[model samples]
Target chain A: MNISLILQMAADADPERIGLVCDGERWSYRAIQRAAHGAAANIADIGCSHIALLDESSEAAPIALFGAALAGIPYVPLNYRLADTDLAALLQRIAPAYIVGDVERAKRLAPEGGHTFCSRKDFVAAAEAAADTASGEEREGEGIAAQIFTSGTTAAPKAALLRHSNLLGYILGTVEFCSATEDDAQLVCVPPYHIAGISALLSSFYALRRIVLLPAFDPDDWLQLASAERVTNAFVVPTMLARIIERIDEGVQADLSALRAIAYGGGRMPPELIDRALDLFPETNFTNAYGLTETSSTIALLGPEEHRSAHNSSDPAVRARLGSVGRPLPTVELEIRDEEGKSLPAGECGEVYVRGEQVSGEYRGKSALDAEGWFPTRDAGWLDSEGYLFLAGRADDVIVRGGENISPGEIEEVLMSHPAIAEAVAVGVPSTEWGEAVAIAIVIRPGCDRPDDTTLRTLIKDRLRSSRVPERIAVLDEMPYNEMGKLLRRQVRAHFQDN
Target chain B: MKPGTKLKSAVCDTEVMVIRGSDVEVMCGGALMSEDTPAEKSAIDTAFAEGTLIGKRYVDSDGSVELLCVKPGKGSLSIGGASLQLKEAKPLPSSD
Candidate 1:
């Protein structure tokens, strides 16, 4: 079924319910559906194969999203922050498209060729004007609902296609229809290009929750908006959370009591950061969601109750659960496999493989699913005896020294535990003696003196084996990270080469 | 019936969208359901007056002929004279 059905069902159930809030404007469920229908008509008239949005969060996002689905075309949300050349390359790839949002940037990069462009203001106006127009009969058969470009930190970006079935499967399996009350509002700051952002819109609409959009993430703006709108739910990346915690530490206070739930994903959450956040928002529910762009959204979630239990537990096994991503969703099946494609028992780290209706695993020209339908997530992880899944960064990020596979997360976790270290990254550098030797870079906490190399070495030796100790340690102002908060390990490795 | 097909009861305000379809005839309030608008309302059958709920899914014993209630009313859902059981909700924490 098309994702447009999500909006249609919600609007039909309660047309007068407030659906979206953005920049002090509120829209009802029916209004959003009418605008989507209007946008769909325009897309069909232009005969565009794809609908692309090249701007930050706005009402136009949901309109263009459901509009493309109604028009029976794929919706592609591009990262506006990409370099001009890279943006131009992506634009060319999805040409013969109806591009919405920043028309100026489209004109500059796309050169008014092979695509239709409309400004965010004009698109919303035109959509409202054509609200009465019929969007035509529902398109038959499953079609691509979205074509999201993966944030290629390790490689070039690839357009990952999520079919309508896959997205619907995720929404239906996880969200209860019309479960959110009228007072419920979700503060969305994640960019539209990310899978979490896309799923946030879909699931919120399905659950009939009001959405409050922040065009761009600013901790100050985010906090103020949440208080003004009484925002009850939010999803943030680790970096965003860290900054928010920092802002709170600086005495930037707002009535954040309305925040009932906060979900975080898109990167690893440091144990220290979470501890601070838990203490700060004692009443709010915290969830650690883990999923890739290939999956529709979250496949595994360390939920609120688990968060509180893990934080308060005295048992070592239960306490370690704070670092896990929790068990897979009820609809999903997960396994950890070794290099030979054999499933490994719990407590052994290996590549993560998942199979579920929501698992698309399909790119523009390729299907990544194996014959058995399991998608190799390429995320190195292991499941504990109780089935809690713990991630050790990406499989490719594993450091190999003398045929011994060492997970960088193991060393990074130890370094991050130090009181003086604020951020740490462990990587393998070329070594004539060990073939590849462990190297580390650390960021010292503000106002804290950098610990000597000997002190740090003893800390590692106390917790891990001597081999895990870094042969060389570099103290830097900060570690490089992508916009989504994922550490740029390749850039970190390059640091050793430069020195 | 086919998946994604919307059907309304002629006897009541109930409306449902087919999630899984089979050759079986879907009944609401003891009357056959149709895609077109009902010209007249009929009295509910006392035997099938248990009532349908909004946003709930009903399915046959075998799990086929699944329907999601987009609109709730006094009508009960059934198939081949057997009342379709309410599908139990498997709640998962919202993580989006």
Candidate 2:
């Protein structure tokens, strides 16, 4: 059940196969295993319960990952983008740990916790030295494999624990071993802290696909590497895809014939962008992966065929499939439930609940799963008659106007349909008459005159009910978003309220 | 070997996990498999000397037993003195 078992399986099956490409250097499966063995021994020597990585994507990511697994400790990947004070505070909370990445940042932590620090190079060297001396003994399967702090889009961050079994269960159920072609190379642009990054590594390792790493995502660099590495597969967030399409439209030409598939998620994708991307990459398969960190990356996905069919379908219902997250994975069971926890019928908006082998509903000290094994995702969504999951905004994002629950997603979608509106987010603003009213922060298309608030309200009113029309509309030059592409609705609300 | 039992090759670096429990002997390169570090290399049995590939599962003809090759090795997998054939891969659509 150990996550390292996946890497060992790949190395055992094809020792000479290339496993990773970083900094223009190729790493074979055997090479990674050997490095992991060394790194594990070093971690074991440190005698820490956790190994935290505070750096960007590097060869050290996988090494520290598998190495921590072999050592029977949880591998924690911290968001390297955190402010110094915030990062130090988090380090203190996870102290008495073996910290790898930026040595200087590690040294800045509180000294009373007995935390140990080492540069990635030093850790690799130490692991290499201990390779022959360390035992690759198998440990119990109950050990934690990784601890990722939730992105905390709406609230304070919480450390989520992913056990060995949860991760292994995901790979076993979703990915077939060695299914990818030897020529397949996957370009990974997500940071190490994200669940997609971890899943990409493990799945690619099991499939024996050569991984090409992008240290940081710049659309141009992503395109350049995709062409140079002949990347056949890749994953990007919604924002990255938008920027790439923008670059392509700006006439940056690079042959991307080698790319066979592209998966995008981590935030809501604008249908217009997906439409352009589908037209731009006619030969490439596109997938809309939907999952939370607690669900181990992807519990549901809109597959390539569905995307193509939905795009070509003329029926309004079928064409609307472009906005859905498709069906749940075979390994997962989905339930849409009301506040009373009663299962709701199709087309009924409710909280999204899921249960599966891969779902780790436990944070560091709390288990969120109910007695029946259903974990409420706290995300508002609905399942249509065809079982397509349409995500509304977060449950907290619901605006209550005179006791009527209004969905911000619905209003935002309507606003986005306007030809002049580029991006829009609807949030609940304080209202004396209606408890809370719909207020929108919008980004208008460049060089387009701002649409009057009355016009925007009329557009939403015509499409939906009059109650759904936004009460306030504040135009902005750009929308506020976190690095992962999740709309910062809280920030948007604060901005509107302040000005 | 029982299901979930990890067996390391005695002749080479091949490792496998028993997917279907069985009493048959799991051999790699004409040598008995063990859960610990394998014994020194043994002479390859000419009939079953074909190299094993990583991540491919090998199973008996009766389908009573299966082993997922965890690591590739110079030794091919065999069960009950009969060489096991590589199982055909099932390609699941890429999710992420």
Candidate 3:
């Protein structure tokens, strides 16, 4: 089934329910469906094999998303933040594609040719004009629903192909259709290019929840919009959450009592931030969601109850779970495997592998799944006896100092525990003696005095092995993060190299 | 229909995918379910009105036939001659 079926379910169940809210306007489920149908009819006429969006988060994003699904074409959301040359290069890869949003940038990609481009405003206007037009017929046979470009932190981004069935599997396996009440609204700040953004649209629409889109993230704007709309649900990256927490602490009276749930992912969340957030919003539910662009959003979720229990628990094991990403989804099977792909028992760190209907490890024409359907997620992590999953950062991010591998996530977690430090990143730097030595860069919280190097080193030595302690420390005004809020480790390493 | 076949209600907006297929009739609101389509309102039976919900699995007594409710409806589901009961729902935390 196409992903549009999800929206159709909501439209059929309650047409009058608010489906999307953006820029001081709201569209009912029926209205969104009509717009999507209009867009679908328009897209089908173009005969493009792919539909791409080069814009920020907006109503046009969702319209293009469902419309592409209905047209039996893959919906591709490109990073609007990429440099002109790089953006044009990626756009050329998907030739004969219909490009929507940011007509300026879409036109810049015109040199590639074989592309039809339109701004979000024109897309909306055209779709509305074609509202009465029939949207052809339901897509038959198997088809690709979305083609998302993975955020290339270490290497060039690859297009991850997500089939309609894979997206449907995620929707069917996770969300309960039309389950959200009429009063429920989810605040979406993540850009359309992110998998979380796409999944949020699908799951929220399927559950009949109102979506409030933030074009770009600003702490003040996010808080103001959430309060004004009385948003009950939201999803944020770790960096966003840290900023929100910082804003609240700085005399911003945010009446977030309407917020019932807040899910965070896309990067590791420090335990200290979670603790502060819980103390501030005692009644709100917190969830730590872990997934990848290839995995169709979240495959494991640390629930609200687990957060509270871990926060209040006396048991060390239970308390340590505050750092875990929780157990696998009911539909997913997870295992930790060694280098040889042999499964390892609990507490033994290795590469993470997952198998599920939603696990679309296929990138373009290449299939990353093994014969058994298990996709090897190149992440260094382990599961406890109770099935809680812990992350040791990306496998590639491991700091191999003198042939002993060390996970940056472990060292970062320990450094973040320090009261003065608000953000910390650990990286491996060139060392003449050890091949590579641990290096740390931190952003101290406002008004907190920066701890001396010896003081900070003693903190790590007390908690972790002396070998894990940072050989060099740099306190910066802020750490580097991509627009989506993921740490740019390559950039962080560059900082140490220059110093 | 065989297992893994997705079907829509013939009498309501309910949609489901067969998980444990059987050679017996599978009815939604007393009407046989087929592909996704609008079922006649008159076909909705008041006798089997417990209603189906999305993300919930409904199964027969011996677990030979199972269906997951992909779309909710006022109509109930049944397999063979037995009414399909709601399986215990183990809700995973909303991840995204």
Worst 10 residues of 3 chain A by lDDT: A133-142
Q: List the residue pairs that clash in candidate 3.
A: none
lDDT of 2 at A309: 95
- Supply candidate 3's per-residue lDDT for B2: 70
Task: Name model 1 segments beyond 4 Å from true.
Answer: A140-142, A432-435, B1-13, B21-23, B32-44
What lDDT tens digits, residue by residue, belong to model 1 across residues A374-473? 9999999999999999999899888889899999989999998889899999999999988999999999999999999999999998999988889999
Please give the clash total of every predicted structure, in order: 0, 9, 0
lDDT of 2 by residue, A15-128 (tens): 899999988989999888888998887777678878899888888899999998988888899998988777877788887899888888678755568888889888877877
TM-score of 2: 0.89
What lDDT tens digits, residue by residue, belong to model 1 across residues B1-96?
Answer: 677678899889999888887566888999999998799988899899988887788989998678988788888999889999998887776788
> Candidate 3: deviation at residue A103, Å?
0.9
Clashing pairs in 1: none
Error of 1 at A305 (Å): 1.4
Best by lDDT: 1
Off by over 4 Å in 2: B1-90
lDDT of 2: 0.86
- Tell me the TM-score of chain B in each candidate: 0.96, 0.87, 0.81
Q: Candidate 3: DockQ?
A: 0.46
Task: Kindly provide the TM-score of model 3 when superposed on the true structure, using C-alpha atoms.
Answer: 0.90
Q: Interface Cα RMSD for candidate 3? A: 2.7
As for candidate 1, its interface RMSD to one decimal place is 1.5
